[model samples]
Target: MFITKSINTFGSYLMLMGKVFARPERMRSFFKQYTKEMSQLGVDSIGIVLLISFFIGAVICIQIKLNIQTPWMPRFVTGYTTREIMLLEFSSSIMCLILAGKVGSNIASELGTMRVTQQIDALEIMGVNSANFLILPKIAALVTMIPFLVTFSIAAGIIGAYATGWFANVINPEDLTYGLQYSFTEWFVWCGIIKSLFFAFIIASVSSFYGYTVEGGSIEVGKSSTNAVVHSSILILFSDLILTQLLTE
Candidate 1:
């Protein structure tokens, strides 16, 4: 039974991907949905991202300074460290983890509630393709917005680092500026952007899958929401590790 269930789940995933790619009509609807989700995922999340990024940058910069004491501890190392952490891990991996908790759970619960209320079945009867209509837009929106969000996150993190350097007096303002200027690299930025796109897909698809497959009553909806967040978070972490290995090596 367990093996059979696993196969069925895997088959469902393949079918979902196939449907997403093969149907032109569905793609149009998905695009429309994407616009709506963009507002929710990108615009709505800006404040939180800003707040988190600021503190993260400051804390990381301070911590790095505290740990290193050699004359060879280049002033530019601060900026390089910030850029490396933000580009490789913070913007992509950590943001997804936050989204999995906030956005993923929300998507699952909303869809699950619709399912329990028979709204999903109503859509089906009305000839609406639930996956294409509901899920696709979210996927599209995430793919489109995550890179932009990462950019904001990177900027905010840098500002935070600057604030810490100025306030703590561990590094001179000119030195911090020099570090930031010296560490700037296009490849690191590109890697972060790519990771953001991948994370967007993972969060949207996983959340939508849980929501679409929801059954039972309100209780089940709650369970599905929890599952969606937990599972999506795990997948994001695993994918980050894989991508890091591939990209860094």
Candidate 2:
């Protein structure tokens, strides 16, 4: 029964996506919504991304310096490890996981509320492609802006690592800078951006699915929002594993 239900849900999700990708009736209106979504879903998220990544980067640097450093180990290892963690995982996969909670819940709740309020029904009555009108812009906006978010996260994390040197006297600033520059791989940055693109799609689409298909009233909307966050987080983790393997190997 579980397998059957899962398959059925997957099928429904695919069908909805088909509807979502249809050509828009009005390009002007679509572009307007697209811009709005870009601001709301992407721009609004930059602050939280920077804030979290900064602290995480500092913590990672401190932990590596204290716990991992050895008598024989180079001091630069802390900076190197911090850079690798930010570029390879935290900026991409972990950041999306955080966003899954923030942006995913917002999408689910907004759509769920619309569903319960019969706003979608009203669109259907007006001959609008409701799925495309509502979901496409969000998906597009997130996918376009996620690369920027990943870049910001990486920069903020690096700065935070350096902050440890300046504020806490944790390490020599010159050594940390050299470590960050040593053996740096440009592809790692691109890898993070690429992984984030996939994660962005998963978060936007999965959350929108739950929200768009919501049943019942306010209670159901709340449940759908919770489910959206949980499922999106799971999918992001699962995909992160696959993407990491493919990108790295």
Candidate 3:
């Protein structure tokens, strides 16, 4: 029964995507929506990303210095490890998981509310391709802006690592700098950006699916929002594993 239900849901999701990708009736309206989503979904998220990444970077550096570092281990290892973790996982996968809660829930609730309030139905009554009109801009905005988020996350994390050296005295600034620059592969950064793009799509599309398909009252809208966050988080993790393997190899 679980497998059957899963397959059915997947089929429905794919069918919805078919409608979502249809050509927009008015390019002007689509562009306007695209700009709005970019602001609402992407730009507004910058503060949280920077704040969280900074703290996580500091914590990761401190943890390594306290627990992982030893007499034999190089001091630069703390910075190097922090860099690798941020570039390879945190900025891309973990950050997206965090976003799945914030952004995903937002998307789901907005759509679910529309569903319950008959707003989407009203659009359909006006002969609008409601799915495309409503969802495509969000998908595009998220995909376009995720790379910038990943980049900002990396910078904030690195600065946080340095902050620990300045204020916390946990690690040497010189050693941390050396470690961050040590054996740096530019591809690791690109890998993170690439992974984030896919994660963004999963968050937007999956959340939109739950919201757009909602079939009940306000209570059901809440349920769909929760489901959107949970499902998007799961998909982000699963895809992260696959993407890491594919990109690294």
Candidate 4:
């Protein structure tokens, strides 16, 4: 039953996506909405992403320094491990999950409230492409913003590791820099961007779907918001694994 339900939701979500991209009735209005969403979704999101990423990187460095048993193990291994983990996994996956809760819930609740308040009905009454007007801006904003956030996260994580290591006397500056630059692959950055794009799409689309399709009152709107976060997080995790496998090959 769960599988069937998921499949149905997936199909409906894709249909909704099609509507989201339909040609806008007024390009100027669409552009205005897009700009607003870009600010709300992207610029507003930087602080939290940076804060979490910096701390995680700092903690990882401290933990790495504490973990090695062998005196022979290079101290710089901390840099490599921290870099790989932050860039490949934490920044893309964990950050997106955080966003799934923060931005996702907000998106769902905002739309859900609009639905429950008959704002959506009013739009349709005016023959507006409500989905396009409401959802496209969000989708466009996220796609543009998430990759930028992930890139910023990677940089912030490395800086955090550097600062923590330097101040805590856990690892030397030379080793940290060497470790990050060691065996670095340009492809890793590409992979991170790819994951961020997919995650951005999933978070926005899933949240919007719940918000747009909500069926009832304030209580139902709240439930839809909860469902949006829960489902988007699950999908982000599941898709991360699939992306890792595919991208590695």
True-structure RMSD, every candidate: 2.1, 0.6, 0.5, 1.2
Could you give candidate 1's per-residue lDDT for residues 19-95 as a string of tens digits? 65545455566666677899987788888888899889888888877786357877778766776787778977897
TM-score of 2: 0.99
lDDT of each: 0.81, 0.96, 0.96, 0.92
Q: For every model in order, what is the number of clashing pairs?
A: 1, 0, 0, 0
lDDT of 4 by residue, 146-234 (tens): 98999989988998999886788778889899999989988988899899899999999999999999998989999999999999999
Model 1 regions more than 4 Å off = 1-5, 22-31, 69-72
Best-performing candidate as measured by lDDT:
3
- The runs of at least 3 residues in candidate 4 whose Cα sits more than 4 Å from the true structure, single-residue gaps closed, are none
Is candidate 1 or 2 superior in lDDT?
2
Report clash pairs, candidate 4.
Answer: none
Write candidate 2's Cα lDDT for 82-115 as tens digits. 9999999999999999999999999999999999
Candidate 1 local Cα displacement, residue 76, angstroms: 2.7
TM-scores of all candidate predictions against the true structure: 0.91, 0.99, 0.99, 0.96
lDDT, residue 143, model 4: 93
Model 3 — TM-score against the truth? 0.99
Candidate 3 deviant stretches above 4 angstroms: none
Query: In terms of lDDT, which candidate is stronger, 3 or 4?
Result: 3
